[model samples]
Target: MSHLVIDIGNSRTKIAIFDDHKLVKNDVLEDLTEEKLRDYLKENSIQQSIISSVRDGIERLENVLIEQTVYIRFSAALNTNINNQYKSPETLGLDRLAGVIGAKALYPGENCLVIDLGTCITYDAIDNDNVYKGGSISPGLNMRLRAMHELTGRLPLIPLDDFDGSEGNNTGTSMLSGVVNGTFLEMAGFIEQYRAQYSELRVILCGGDANFFDTRLKNSIFAHTLKTEPDLVLIGLNEVINQQ
Candidate 1:
C-alpha cells in the first residue's frame, strides 16, 4: 500500500507518496487545504497516510484525509529518540522534530548531523547510541539578506543565486557572498564544534539552502558530498505515524 505523507512547513506544505518504503512522487504546495489535499490524494492510490505540520492548519486537511484513508499526525514526546532539552518542548517547530526523526530513521546506528537550511537554519544531531541530542538554530539566507535590507537604509535587498564557488565582485554579489559565505562558515563552525565533542559525525544537509551550502562547502570540512532529499520531513512524518 502506498502511504501519503504531508509536511506542513513555515512557507509551504510538501506532499509525497511512499510505496513500500520508497518515495514515488513528491511536490510542494503553497495552498494546503482540504480541497487541494483531497485532489492530490485522489490522484494517487493511497490507503494509509501521515501528516506533520509546523505551521498549523491540519484540522481541515485531516478531516478530508480521514474520509479516504487512515491519517495520522506526527507529534513530539519524550518517547521519541530525541531529548527535549529546550525549556519548552511544545514550542519546538514540528519541522525540526521531523528532521531529527528523519535523520534517525535514514541513518540508524550512526552519528549523523541533520542540517535543515530553510526559513531558519537548524542543526540536529543523533549520536551513535541512537540518542537524539538537541541542535541549534540561526537565521537563514533570505532572512539574512532581508535583515540587511530592512535593518539598514543603504543596503539593497539582494537575491541569492546558485552557489558557484565563493568569491563575489559587485554590490549584490558582495551581499550574496556575505550571506552565503557567512552561512557556510556558521555551518562549518558548528560541524567543527560538534566534531570536537563527538568523534565521528555524519552530516546530512536538507532544505532550500542545502544545495548552496553543499556545493560550496563540500571539500572544506564537510566530510560527505551534498545529499539533497526534499521530502525528508515527509518521510520522517510517515515514520512517526507508522509507529503510532
Candidate 2:
C-alpha cells in the first residue's frame, strides 16, 4: 500500500510518497493547494495520509485528505516509539519531534543528533535508549543575514550565494563570513558538546540548508559521523503511519 506524508513548514511544504517503508517520491513546494494534493492522490494509489503543519489555515487541505484517505493529523501525542521527555510536549514543534523520530527510525539503537537547517536551525537528540529530553534552536543562515540588516542600520542583507566561504575583506563579505562561518562554528561547537556526552553520536543534517552544512562539515573532522537526509521529516511521518 502507498502512504502520503506532508510536512508544512514556515517556508515550504514537503510531500513524500512511501510504498510501505520505502520512499518512492519526494517533492518540495513553496505552497501546497488542495488541487495539487488531488493530483498527487490521482497519480498514486495512496491508502493513508499524514500531515504535520507549523502554520494555520490548512482546513481545506485537511478536509480533502480526510475525505480521500485515512488522514492522520500529526501531533505530539502520536506514538512513534520514542520516549519524549520534553517539558512542554504540546508546544514542541511537530517538525522537531518528527526529526527526532526520523533519527530513531534511521539509526534505530544509535545515539543521534538531528540538526535541521531551515528557517531556523534546530538541534534535537535521541539516545540509544530511545529517550528524547530536549534540543536547541537558533536563527538560521538566512535569518541571521536578515536580522543583521533589520536590526542594524549600517548592515546590508548578504545573500548565501555570495558567500564563497572565505575570510572577508569587505563589508558584505565580512557579514557573510560572520553569519555563514559563525553558524558553522556554532554547529561544530554543539556537535563537540554532544559528542562529549555520547561518544558514538551520529549527526544527521536535514532541511533546506542541509547540503551546505554537509559540504562544510565533510571537510572537517565530523565527516565520518555525519549524514544528510533532506527528506527526514517526511521519513519520520511515514514511520508514524507504519507504527499505526
Candidate 3:
C-alpha cells in the first residue's frame, strides 16, 4: 500500500509518498494548502496518511486528508512499540518522538542518536531495545546568530552561507566562527558524550541544516557512524503507518 506522510516543521513543510518501505516522492514547501494536498491525492493512490505538525492552523488540510484517506493523527500518545520513558510524554514534540522512531526503524537492534538541526537542535537517543529515555535541545545555528545580533548592538546578523570555519579575521567572520564553528563543536561534543555511553551508537542527522553538519562531520571522528536522512521525520511517520 502507498503511504503519504507530512511533517510540518517550524520553517518548512515536508511531504513524502512511500510505496511501502521505499520513498517514491518527496517535497519541501513553505506552506501546504488544501489545493496542493488535493493535487497530490489526485496524482497518487495514497491509502494511509500520517501527519506530524509542530504548529497549528492545519485543520482544513487535516479535514481533507481525513475525508479522502485513512488519516492517522500522530501524537505522543500513539503506540508505536517504543518504550517511551519521557517524564512528560504529552509535552514532548511529536517530531522528536518520530525522529527516534525513525532511527529505530532504520537501524533496528542498535543504539541510535538522532540529532535534528532545524529551528532548534534536538539530540534524542533510542537504545538497542527501543527505549527512548529522552535527550537534549539547544539553539540552532540561525537562532544563535539571530540571538547574538538581536541581543547585542554591534554584532551583525551573519548569514549561514558566509560561514567558512576559519578563525575570525573580521567582525562578520568572527560571528560566523562563533556560531557555525561553535555549533559544530557543540554537536561533536554531544556525539562524543553519547558515544561514551552507547559504545555502538549510530548518529542520524536530519532537518534543514543536516547537510551543513554532515559535510563538517564527514572528516571528523564520528564520520563512520554518522548518517544523514533529511527526510527522517517523513520516514518515521511512514513507519507509523506501517505499524498500524
Candidate 4:
C-alpha cells in the first residue's frame, strides 16, 4: 500500500507516492483534471491521500480523493513535532510549515534554515529547540521578472538563466543579471545573516529553483554547504502521514 501526497501550488501540482516512508514515485503536473486524478488513484494501491494546497479549486479534487481513497486534510493542526511560535498560524502557508517539519524530520536536534525557492522564495528556520520562529518571504526569480515587466512601461518579461557576475550588456541580459544574480546575492546574504546567529545551522534549500541555486552556490564553497531537496514538500507531506 502507498500513501499519496499532493501539493497544489499556484503554478504547478506535485504528486508523490510513498510506500511506507520511502518515496516510490514523484510527478509534476501542470494540467490537472478530476478524471486524471481519478485515473491515477485507480492505478495505484494507495492506502491514504493527503493534500496541501496553496490556492483554491482543489475542492473538486478533494472529493475525488475521498471517493477513491482514505483522505487526510493537511492543516496547521497536524502533529509536526515542532512547536509553532509564529504570530499568525492561520495565515501561514501550509507548504512553508511543512517545509520546516520536513527539515526537522531530516535533521533532528540541529538548527535548520529552510530556504524554499518556488513561486515565492520563503525563508523558514526552526531553531535547535524545535521552535518554529517565523521567517521572511520575497518574490521569487520568475516573480521578479514578471513584476519588472508588469510594473515598467517597456521592460519585457525575459527568461532568466545565465549570470557572469557582471552587469549585462543589453536590456535582456541586464534583466537576467538583476533578477537571477540579484537573487543569488540575496540568498547568500540571508544564509550569512542566519549563520551569524545560529553558528551550527543546517541550511536546506528546496522547491523548483533549488537545483539552479544549488549548482550556482556550490561555486563559492562557503564554510557550510547548502543542502538542496527539490522534493522537500512531498517528503514533508509523507512525514505528516507518518506522524499520525
Task: Write model 4 residue lDDT over 47-119, tens digit each, in one string.
Answer: 8999998997789999998987888888887667879988888888999988988888788899988999999
* Candidate lDDT values, in order: 0.77, 0.92, 0.92, 0.86
Q: Candidate 4: where are CA atoms >4 Å away?
A: 161-167, 221-223
TM-score of each: 0.91, 0.97, 0.97, 0.94
Q: Give the clash count for each candidate.
A: 0, 0, 0, 0
- Candidate ranking under TM-score, highest first, comes to 2, 3, 4, 1
lDDT of 3 by residue, 18-122 (tens): 999999999999989999999999999999999999898889999999999999999888889799999999889999999998998899999999999999999
lDDT of 2 by residue, 1-244 (tens): 8999999999999999999999999898999999999898898898999998889899999999999999988888887799999999999999999998988999999999999999999999999999999999999999999998999989997888898878999999999999888999999999999999997999999999887778889989999999999889999999999998
lDDT for model 1 comes to: 0.77
Candidate 1's clash total is 0
- Of 1 and 3, the candidate ahead on lDDT is 3
Using TM-score as the yardstick, the better of models 2 and 4 is 2
Q: Among all windows of ten consecutive residues in candidate 4, which has the lowest summed lDDT?
A: 217-226
Worst 10 residues of 1 by lDDT: 221-230
Per-residue lDDT tens digits of candidate 1, residues 1-244? 7889887777777888988678888887886777787788777899888777766556888888888988765566635666546556777777887887787788777787788989899998778776664779899999999999999988888767643555778777788888888888888898888888877777788887677766566667564633566667876776776566
